[model samples]
Target chain A: MPKLINKNTVITNPWTVMKASTGPEILQVVPGKNFIVPLQFWKLYQEELNEYDGNIAVWLDSDENPEQISDELHSLPLIALNFPVFSDGRSYTNARELRQKYAFKGEIRAIGDVLRDQLYYMAQCGFDTFEIRHDQEAELCLQAFNDFETGYQSTVAEPVPLFRRR
Target chain B: MYRYDGYDHQMLADRVAQFRDQTNRYIDGKLSEIEFLPLRLQNGLYVQRLAPMLRIAVPYGMLSSTQLRKLAYIANHYDKGYAHFTTRQNIQYNWPALVDVPDLLADLAEVEMHAIQTSGNCIRNTTTDQFAGAAPDELEDSRAYCEIIRQWSSFHPEFAYLPRKFKIAVCGTVDDQAATQVHDIGIYIVKGDNDEIGFRILVGGGLGRTPVIGKEIFDFVEKKHLLTALEAILRVYNREGRRDNKYKARIKILVKETGVEEFKNKVTKEWALIKDSSLTLTDEEIDRCQKFFDAPNYQELSNTPTQLTDKLQSNILFAAWHSQNVKPHKVTGYSIVTVCFKETGVAPGDVTDRQLEQIADLSDEYSFGEIRISHKQNIVMADVRQDQLFELWKALESGAMASNNLGLLTDLICCPGGDFCALANAKSIPIAEAIQRKFDDHEELTNIGEMNLNISGCMNACGHHHVGNIGILGVDKKGEEYYQVSLGGSSKNNASLGKIIGPSFAQEEIPDVVETIVGVYKEKRIGEEKFIDTYNRIGIDPFKEKVYAKAD
Candidate 1:
């Protein structure tokens, strides 16, 4: 069980990450299974949203248009996007637009190469949780989020602008 | 130089303490290596091939004698007794223990200096002309704006984690000595027709794997809205810059993709919102900042000193040095003395601790305790009196700083390559040294006349290889070093990136290639035309023919 620290409180992480029974939960999507939802999964099961609900996560390619997905799918429990590398900050924009413009309010998480340095930034972009790799220390990644004492600009979490601050 | 007020001092002190705590936590196993990486990088600590390298910001290359002495002390005490002056006018210590870095930060804070934003993907030290305040034909002193930007960008919350490192440079004079064109944001402080000071803002310029000359965003950005306009530009970049691919993340790439007009519009829209805010510069604040850089009390004397004439007539060496290492200062009696770092048989920009101390002494004795590091990897004492020129030259000569190759072939801007830097693909110092060795004779160098050869280890182009009249770039082929040559580049007012001649050549053949290029220049030149003018006239065909003829 991982202890999750939100913006102001520490609580038990409710989402059960899937993995091989023998390996770390961070390594697998779900127990003994890789729950990958294809583009067609959203289209084919548009009306059966509650039927397929479980401890599963969704992934999207950069080429995939978010507008094509049904509005109902936005209420999913977990969604993780891949960051190819440190230099590719396109996903950051996508993440921000998805949360701010599209209003995808569910648990939007980052999956790949989500290094510790990017935790604070990812959080600012409205990622409530991060599905960091098994090799990475989750506890350390969490600490990186709180590393800076002050931020000069407002984001989704803190709407009061930097200039307005006393 | 921007003096640190109470707020600035407190921020720097807090930053140092924060870094110290982060370092302790990492060592105590509370923070992982991955987690601690950005924290350390933000503090200007980079783990290099040999040891951790810490780059200390000498804002706009201006330093007091006290600051230089502190740097000398740090260089001697903590690491090697040598520091390399970077193209951005920052000083990089090659070998500092990671554990002692916090202490180094503490030491730096004592001198009102810190390594903050020197590394990581943030706005770096805002560079300006080394002769910002003193240069003739100046519209406004650029250091005042540089200081304001420094304060505004210091640990800026929104921009701390930029998609890529951002660099800004301001040039006040007509001459683009700061290489403003290649920065992320290049601001030219110019007076409008109405005699109001404003900036001609250029955005998305940078030198790296992909070299780009910035495009003009604003023809006349008013003095009041400078900060707000800059904020708007940054906001647009923060919101829209490419993060998926590292190579394509620079604002240049954004400008290229979005087109300058569209990018300008986006910035304008963002600016419209923030322009009337607190970030807008007021006349009072601007005037206050400008007061500090008010011109020194210059005494007028004859340009030609009787003693100088005697020295020049008697000593040819002194004459050559004077011709090359000294520039015409705005004041009649004073001259800007360029202390060349490009000495033969020595790595360019590497100044020993002893040399730094001597420089500090010279600055105090001759130039009102102020020294400047030029973009050309040299130091400048901007206010050297005509009468004290001989004494200054004599002292510099004793310290091995009086290299009579200020703008000559030997005055190469060479980067630390495989010998020290981990990012380098091939060694650059050896190539620079080889060329220096070939052109060692003072008379021969003077005859070649006013050449600028810039060498970079890799495509990252830290040496400003793109804008050199003669550029040498080191490339790797099958684990072996090869050098590529380019010509006709210039970073002055008419700035342009170099054009590569052709294929890469073996390391040993670079000197001959350079000679052939010079040979072509000499043969085609009309009445003491420079290498750039010669290259421009004859084009690269003749040089290419001579350089590659022996290859096949």
Candidate 2:
């Protein structure tokens, strides 16, 4: 698994993405491994997912509504939003909605097509952890976190805007 | 005029260094050409038909004398000894090397300026009225608000990767001289019912292949809520804006697809969550930016100076220039003078290095060491005394910057067409020259009255042909260059797109066709009616019948 960088520091990645499957074994979570179920699959097997003993997480596509999973968010360790393309940027808003609107305190992760160039902005919009592509250099990408020392507008991390501070 | 603090200064330095690293990576082949295209564009670098072109932002069309001198230095030492001002109130260097661009940006960053967001899918320059603070009829100065928006949008986290080039314009009056109706987002600063200052927000207005006047999203948004409302709109656009098709991905398409009321609902929904956040401007913050745009010191003098009256009585050319080039100002003794770069045969907005330095010197001598670039492609000195108008006119005439045509037919709003841009269909410069030569006589053009003749070499509408009174578009017919004509478009208060006239004309016939169109306008017009007014009164059919009368 690729290393997860959260807030400019590398962290151990524990969650394994569970592909959509209806197998009998799919409902049984491994004792040590955490499973990140897609929102669709999670909706279909909510009771099965809730009963599992290991850590549980939810991942969403660009079209998935954040409000749909709000009740289940308390049972999850983190919410990962998939970026089909880096330029699409729908997931950034999804992340923002998760943090600001729903008040989801658990970790917010960005996955799929995530790149080094976009990590800084993702961080600004409230993504704490990034699941970078396996082939990319994670350490080098982390440098983007501090690309600019300051920003004019406020973000999730910095509540006071530059203008307000001035 | 907004001064940069240490934080802004360091950010600029860091951005330049980041770009230099990106350039190095591209040169090392670590980043492919396709991968580097958007990166270079965000920095205002374009690989054109000729050499690479670099466009530098002049925020809200305001530039200091020191900035102009720095530009002159760049033009003389780096590229050719000239720079071209664009319709969006920015300057373009035609021949900067691809590698030298980062160095050029470093030079620009020294003077509290950089080329960030000048060209990209992100938000471009925030243009305002050239006479923003000076115009007597304006309600409030819009420059500080524009500066606020600029800072907010610059390197914005979510909005840096928008679908297409986004343009925003602000105007402080009903005049709409900045062509607010044709930008992506337009802000009109106005007084509310209780005499409170607010903005009338318009969104999705643009002038490309699909010409649409922006719809008013909000009739009034309070001053503190400006950033929140804007953020909401941008967030909606970023999340829901079409990304599959490059051409159909502008916010206009999203606004069109969602409908205005529906789009407003979506933005209002987003605004509810972020309205009370840190983005809301404090009164102190507003006052901080407003202080920079405060009025310059002026000496008490007569509105009608004796020297100016003597010059007007003696020199006919000087009097004619004063009547056209000078605009009324808020101050009694001062007037805003537009130093026209449209000297008949020369390109509309091209200025040489020497002229740049000289204009800087002129700004120091006459105006308060500041210059403004108008959307109509001209330079403005806003604080010149009426007594010094004659002397300023004399200096402008010596440098071939004195042209009495401010809004006439020869004052062409044209793009660097097939000559410089790779995407153009024909040569726009030669077309401008041809039309200028055709109407070389001062008396004939003056008789024609107020008319707009805009030219673009392609459908991208950089020349804003869609909003011109008499619009011309260059089309590629087989292998030859052909010109298409449109009539009755206006970007003023009553914003409307031009209708295409029948049959395209060849290069040689363009001037004659323009003359024929103008001939119909002059004949059909009532006493002292402008061309747009005449076209609006007597529909396009009469002129269509006249010009295509011979061809058909």
**Interface-residue RMSD per candidate?**
4.7, 1.3
Q: Residue B19's C-alpha lDDT in candidate 1?
A: 87
Summarize candidate 2's per-residue lDDT along B440-516 as a digit string, tens digits: 88778888977788999999988999999989999999989999999989888889999998888999998888989
Q: Number of clashing pairs, model 2?
A: 0
Give residue B211's error in model 2 in angstroms.
0.9
Against the true structure, what is every candidate's RMSD? Answer: 5.5, 1.8
Worst 10 residues of 2 chain B by lDDT: B30-39
Error of 2 at B33 (Å): 2.9
- What interface root-mean-square deviation (Å) does model 1 yield? 4.7
Tell me the tens digit of each residue's lDDT in model 1 across B1-552: 567666567667777877887899789987678668778888889999989899998888999999999999999998789999998999999998989999999998999999998998889999989887777778778999998787668766557667899999999998889999999999999888789889999998888889988999999999888888887888678767887788998999999999999999989987886677656676777786788787777887988888888988988878888998888888888888989998777889999999999999999999999999988889999998988889899998898788888888988898888889999989999999899887778887788898889999998998888889999998999999998889988888778889999999899999888888888888888998888888888888888888888676
**Interface DockQ per candidate:** 0.13, 0.67
